[model samples]
Target: MSRHIQDRIGRRLSTVFPCPDAVEDTSRLGQVLLRLAQALAPAPAGNPVPDSFRTDLLAAVPQLRRYALAQCRNAAEADDLVQTTLMRAWENRSRFEPGTRLIAWLFTILRNAFLNQRKRLRREVEDVDGAFAATLSLEPEQERRVELIQLQAALNTLTAEHRETLLLVMVDGLLYEEAARVLGCRTGTVKSRVSRARERLALALGTD
Candidate 1:
């Protein structure tokens, strides 16, 4: 890669410096060494991932996001899935082999993670068409007066964590990853809070 690319990635990844160009070598060991260097460059900011490795991560983001979007079909869920994949990949980077396809490895992790999430939500009914509001069976639940007042009161009763997650994901239309970025927590934590908050709201409103 060019020095400009390296320097740009260095800034983006919070690395203090750029890396030297790889020496020409056709040998397998040389190839492995180069790959390892790119995969594990030391960060000057005390981050484990250096500019070289971080470039790889940044390069993979778009593709990873596409895969996530395909799997979840929900922007928020897709962003959460992508964040989970990246976090897990960072934690388990040592398990990645040098000279192998890093993108393939990341894609594998994304697929597995998506499937696991699907398993967790399998029992719950999803409203893909936004039809839930039209299907309310109770007259009181459909009434505007009761809904506006009672729902507001119930929301006021939620813990800060639960309320924020619900509003961020539901009202603001932000992805879980975006909310997590704003909230300084993992996407899974945001997901849990939203779930709990919804349950609490349901219980308070006599909807569950």
Candidate 2:
């Protein structure tokens, strides 16, 4: 190894990669370090379907729905997209890089499926003057439903990129790096989109 490379490593100044299953602190700096390590590590080759794959996938359904609704704005269409994504992910299990984050993988599949279907079907639904809010629900069932309507409308006004970014980072709690992976974009792009989305939503809802 060159002395320059060794010096970089000794100082921990080299770039770090991200890995799916590496659990670390929630802080942004911590995530950055973890991702750096992940990036340096070789990808797990082949598909050794983990025992939790099915269960984990099932668990991710609600998140998938939230993302889908934000993307397509219709409840039924969101459900269909989730279904299609799950089906495709399952069918392509062998292609999945092992030891990676399942949700990110599934999300990538869902996103691609959504984009492809949008191209073919171009199906549009009435957003009820409000797109569904991923975070809606406060009081009584009926009242919550009403609030959700308004939230949905506000959500619909956002650009698709903003909506998807908010859903991934805010709703799903994915780190920016993880979100970038799922969205097939850079971490900087994910961060920017989330910032813009939050500002727009705050303006729309008049929240602090």
Per-candidate local distance difference test:
0.55, 0.60
Writing each residue's lDDT as its tens digit, candidate 1 over 42-127 gives 65565566454566765666556645553454555766776677778877877877665566567668767876787887843232
Best by lDDT: 2
As for candidate 1, its clashing pairs are none
Query: TM-scores for all candidates?
Result: 0.38, 0.61
Worst 10 residues of 1 by lDDT: 12-21
User: Which stretches of candidate 2 lie above 4 Å from their native place?
Assistant: 1-48, 122-128, 131-157, 203-208
Please give the TM-score that candidate 1 achieves against the real structure: 0.38
- Native-referenced Cα lDDT, model 2: 0.60
After best superposition, candidate 1 residue 133: deviation in angstroms? 24
